[model samples]
Target chain A: MTERTATIASRVGLHARPAAIFAEAAADLPVEVTIARLGEPAEDALDAASILALMGLGAAQGDVVVLRAEGDGADAALESLVRILETDHDA
Target chain B: MHTYSGVGVTPGRVVGPVRVMPPAIAAPPAGEQREGTTTAEAAAGNLRSAAAVVKEELRGRAAKATGDGKAVLEATALMAADPMLLKSAVKLIDAGASAQRAIWEAGDGVAAMLLDLGGYMAERSHDVLDVRARIVAQLRGVPAPGIPDADAPFILVADDLAPADTATLDPAKVLALVTAGGGPQSHTAIIARNLGLPAVVAAAGVGELADGDEIFVDGGRGVVTTDPGDAEREAASRWAEQVSRLAGFDGVGRLADGHRIPLLANVGGAKDAVAAAAANAEGVGLLRTEFCFLGHDTEPGHDEQVAAYKGVFDAFPGKKVVVRTLDAGADKPLPFLTDATEPNPALGVRGFRTDGTSPGVLARQLAAIADAAGQSRADVWVMAPMIATADEAASFAALCTAAGLQTPGVMVEVPSAALTARHILDHAEFASLGTNDLTQYTMAADRQLGPLAALNDPWQPGVLALVQATVEGSRAQARHTGGPGRAPKPVGVCGESAADPALAVVLAGLGVTTLSMSARAIPAVSAVLRSVTAETAGSLARLAVSAPSAAEARSRVRARLPVLDELGL
Candidate 1:
């Protein structure tokens, strides 16, 4: 199992356009991916696509979160997700 | 019988079951969320489903109102293309959040982003009214917005009222309204009160009504009689029948002998323009220019405003369009406005009083009207606001007249001006009562206060007295001012009161030649005209002005005829 923490960088956490973009990215990944928050009690922040879960982690503009993937493309998937978050899509 | 309460919009009585459309819930369809395979994918799937649901719901509403569903589709496309929500949804799973929670949080984030983008769009230039468009899209559910004469009379139950929904509600037939959610500040409350639909809100157990259940509602008392007793049903029946029987009320507003007072619609947008047209308003009395200014940073150039203004102008060909020039300040802020931050924006610079800050704003707004008027020979009237003394009205009117917009007028929202209406109207072409703010100012009560809503009544004798003052002022001006050739331009009620048929009669009685409100309010006003003669309406206005309390005044007016009672007076 490999896990990496990433912060919620997008302004709107995930309800609208951002949800579609990220969903497309993880559409065909060959790994089992899960999400977690630093201080949450393990059950609160598990669903990556669930905007509410990510917000429950209390992640604001700069709060970092953890991402984990286990399977063949785990490393590549993690890197891509991280790259998407870190690099400003427009600004 | 089930019961709930909302503010009474239009006063009318009907016997009918209830139609409670569900609140446009913000969940995605289940299928889209099922698309996710991996744990992260699963999270994305949930988020997609939620988005899909909201999209579908909004799309259905949008499709009903416009061609091609332009606004909803845009919002949906933005949602579908959103990467942030999906990312956060997956991250939520990684973070131990339930898939549902992740989708909600992510959507919130994205909404914030879009709002920011909308703001950015406003700052960039004036093209689309992005924020207003979003609001319009959000409120697009009222297609046909008109309720059919239900096979049986019925009340409407909704979570909240949107402007469109209110626009569609049939005042002629509906009995009353019971809404689950709405505050005093909600447009639903305002429109409900305007329409006089006996309504109640915040009542417990009113939300459980099954479709077609019979109930009796006392809107004035906010009481619901579920499975109404025979007495309640009898009273409701008598009321509905009597009100319906008093139709074909003769003549427009009349004076002592007989003079037709023009009743018009106060329109703010193209939608309102269309609604006003449908309502058969005599003309557009108060054409707020701000609707065109919506969603733009810089003032809309002459051509842009002209196009929108022309749409409204064309809505009622040959009728008068009372265009108020760049009245931005406080409550209705413009992106281009400078130095607008004020603790009490209402009391601060706004309306015609914004001159010292920037006369150019007024100039541009007037210029736009002039440009719009250039296209046709329609009778277009222009006006200004916040005129306390005669000088302000004179200056604003002069500017408009200089630009070729006719019938420059002043809105008597300020108490002092309403009292000295003659002095103000002496300098301008006409006057119109801004009763909502006028009442608020008269009582010094915050009209927006939920608890103090009862005191914000426009019919309060004090407000009526102020209205009387404006009438006296305008009447005196009509006699003394206008000079040899020009007849005193007609004064009217252009606030919330004018759209209300009951209040329309009162205004006509009070001596306002015109009554204007949301285009949707025209029919109700016309109905009031059909219900009573101007002499009776004038008599009612006088009583309304002298009565000690709003309730007392309203009761007296209703007592004049059983028809009023039947209309749920």
Candidate 2:
């Protein structure tokens, strides 16, 4: 498994437009990815491709979250997802 | 014909077939076993297909939409196909739940989770429910719950509209809006106003209206007549003709004799100023400065304030722009300026009174206004709100002069200010009547309460009397200082009353020098003002002020002004 942590940068956090964008990106990747707030139990992780799950995570602006990916191109998927989380879509 | 009454938020008339928005989809019966499908796997497969169908339909709509609408639809589409949602539904199906019940309960669980997260996340729960409804409707072989599709123009009737429902509304096909629920400030009324669709809200029993039922909607009077006869149809046609004439207003306010009365707009920020300019407002009458102060925990710096003010000032080059100082407190309390624990905020320290608690804030604002004015060619006039005494006006004017700005004014919102306008004008250069506040203060009624709407009306005889007093005091001041031929200080009205065509005429007749209102109201006001002479307005004003009540005042003045009926006002 490839794992990464990134802080939410969108002013409104991982909801609405930013969540939709990240979910679309995650769904397009070859590797399956799951996300959970940092310090949350591993079992609490949710499918990163689901906008509903991302919104349900309640990740606000400046919150750090952990992303884990598996299978082919896992590392590349984690890197791209981390970049999306760090970028301020609002700006 | 059965007639339903509601509060009218906009003015116009129309008759068309009704298009009732479909009610929300009912939740599926709980604990029902899977039908037709032989196994749990078959039930789960059915759920997946239903979700896919909903996702595809949403994706189709998202492809055609743009901007925020497109973003919302795309997000909803993603929710429809969310794997986690399907997994939960499938889990339920394995536990002996039917496909319909499984998906419904699964959707609720997700929505409840989002709701538990609270704040912005809680708002998204509604979107989940909306998507769930669509999927459920698809599975049930029923029409989706939302705005119904129609081929031609129709009057839309709904219990109330959700913000998402209004997003897909095609304004061209909506002739008018009538809702059984919601008030004048509801989402439906506001959107109706923006789309220029006549709307009546809080109309009881309007939900009973059926599809394709002919209805006559008189938004000006907040009346909905069912199965209207030829007379109502003729009136609707006449109103349509009058509305087209109103569109031709040349952006100038004048009387029949060509006496000019400048029509200005009340704007909140630079964006509103741009729209006001596009609407050809002679200038801004009330540029509310609270936008800079409302959201900040600490006061905005001098440069930030200057930049914000300059944006508005730049929009009306070489034209008058009257800016009201930060009127914080009472209903618009600011943490940095007001004591939230005050027993009576309305009667407590507010508006100009806030300066006493937070010194230098008003001074800094004045300096910023002067700085912005120096950079722009706009004729900037500064004013303070909630001034109850001549001394407050003098002190406020002194601050303006100290900041190197001229043309300091005071808003005549308090009864005392109107009573002592002659003295207040002794120090202030101009006085603008805020009729909404003046009426509230005069009648001792809370303006925000719906029940007090009658007493809070600007047409109340007591309120009109105070307006006359302020105008008379201004004239008296002019005579005292510059003799009989001198003009009174330029007193304008920047209030909701100024937007009413009939009331605008009465205000002009009462010696008000200018009328300022929302940008959308300028055309109708300008058109109506051009239909009456100064002499006629004076008589109408007299009739209004001498009337016993607000209703009587309105009827008396409206009866004398034949142009109102001619224009379907």
Candidate 3:
């Protein structure tokens, strides 16, 4: 398994709509994302993109985040996430 | 002029000039530049210097204002410190726009940026946002909606209060606080009630209130109009006087025939307990211990719980305190109890039976209550909820006895508990009727379920039958234990039910030795009890229990009583 780093780019960052979009993207996939706060350890509680749970991570700008993908379309899954975060869907 | 209604937030009547906050003024346009200034940089410098002056003025005022006005300064100070706004302002200044334009544009940019960064309040507090909006308006020389004090007494009206802005207002000077917007949880509302300032928000056309106009504000009815006629003024004055009388009341529960029923305060935390104790309340009726254990990684240690209990107990030297052990795991959630699934949190495994399963949690909690009680002269009573069978009640009694706790009691909350109060009391020293939960369970309706809330009325015959049955069971137990005060010691009502003034009289009249409720509602309840004699109260309680409908129950009580002179009812 390889881990990649990405920033949240969609305008409605990791809240109600973003949580749904990100959950749908990860459903049934052999991948996991841990939303970490500016200075916190990643934990299993971040298994789902719950708006409140994600907020616990406290991710903000100029911050580093880790995404891990395993099995077959790992590359494709990681690439899709990068694009999702890079574009401001909230705009 | 438009007139909207809201809860009256502040009290009093004043007639004076209205001082609307000054509007933010914009600088000269680029096309109309001064003869000497050919470049946009010159215009930018002029605008920048002017903004500096306004910002400084804002800073100076925030430091000086009192009450809600002082809160505004605190919030304004924070808005003035926002990194995003400050950064944008710098950028606009670099781009050569006028000072006012730069400030306004910077604010707009920051709002747009944060709205895009959504999460669960990840953008920060609404109060912080309000501060930015007001500052920007001031920067542009636009009419800021801030209410002002014009030396003389006058009605103060506005759209809404920023927490900081509403904090500095003088309750006495303020004729009334009439605003266009707010909710039950709004800061203005909380502060108004906390400070005993009668105010009304959600009033329409409050801004249209011209200067030097005569207006009478009814805080209780949430009304503010231009000079109320004589009748209305008399009525409002009577109500105000009544409220003042009730607020000053400090009497204990007494029967017209001279019987005594202890009136106690229901406190949520040690701070509340201290405040109540200072008010000369008989003792704490319900000390919600959840405040000590909530938001923690593990269950609090015996020492920690004991410390908390001791603080509340120490506040009142000789007053009795009833400590209700852990009412959490339902309606209330503990940080570590996350995975405990609940289809409906309110009606589910809460009160006591649910938490009792963990002996370690129970034992430590029991020991803590016992220890706190030992330190004070006041007798500390230990109690639990949701105990239906004799076995459950006995187990709690055994635990409390084992831990040296006095008078381990059972709360008659569920229908099962009320139906078998005799059996439950066999193992306990006392019983307190929690009618709110009993009514919910008896009616088979979720009390918190808004759509079906009507079914949970305490006056419903089914609910009344359950309460009457519980009282009957208590009486039966008294007969078995050698009669009168010798039975299980004491019977009381300690819940939201205990807060109702009319209901307090009824409960005391029904032989309940004590009635406990929020400290704020205690004075009013005491006044109601004092007004009626014990003989009248007993019969009234019977009438209430016999009523078929909630409205009928209330009406019957009111028809028989003269009036609520002190409470202004």
> How does residue B504 of candidate 3 score in lDDT?
70
Give the candidates in order of DockQ, highest first.
2, 1, 3
Tell me the DockQ of each model, to 2 decimals: 0.04, 0.64, 0.02
Please give the lDDT score for candidate 3. Answer: 0.62
Scored by DockQ, the top model is: 2
Candidate 3: where is the Cα deviation over 4 Å?
A: A1-91, B1-229, B249-251, B338-341, B354-359, B443-462, B483-488, B565-567
Evaluate model 2 with DockQ and give the value: 0.64
lDDT digits (tens) for residues B1-569 of candidate 1: 44454445444444457766554434433324322344765555554565454455445544654432344233443343234445655676676665555555555555554345443222221111222122222323322212333555568766656554553466765667776655343455676665646666545566787677777776544566667777777777776675554343232533434557666777777677776667566778777777777544456666777788888888877878887776777557664563444788877777776778766777877777888777855688877767788988888878887888767888888899987888887778788778877877787776555445567767788888888788777767777755556465567788887655566678777777777776544544565566676667767878877888877887788677455444555
- Give per-residue lDDT, candidate 1, residue A2: 74
TM-score of chain B of 1: 0.74
| Cα shift from native, residue B497, model 3 (Å) | 3.1
Compared with the true structure, model 1 gives a TM-score of: 0.67
Model 1 interface CAPRI class: incorrect
Docking class of 3: incorrect
Interface RMSD of each: 8.7, 3.1, 13.9
lDDT of 2 by residue, B256-338 (tens): 99999999998889999998898889999999999888645468899999999999999999999999999988767676788
Return the clash pairs for model 2, or none.
Answer: none
Candidate 2 residue-wise lDDT at B135: 87
lDDT of each: 0.62, 0.87, 0.62
User: lDDT, candidate 3, residue B452?
Assistant: 42
Score every model by TM-score: 0.67, 0.75, 0.59
Residue range B433-491, candidate 3, lDDT tens digits: 77767776677665444334346555565666676677778788878877666544477
In terms of TM-score, how similar is model 3 to the real structure?
Answer: 0.59
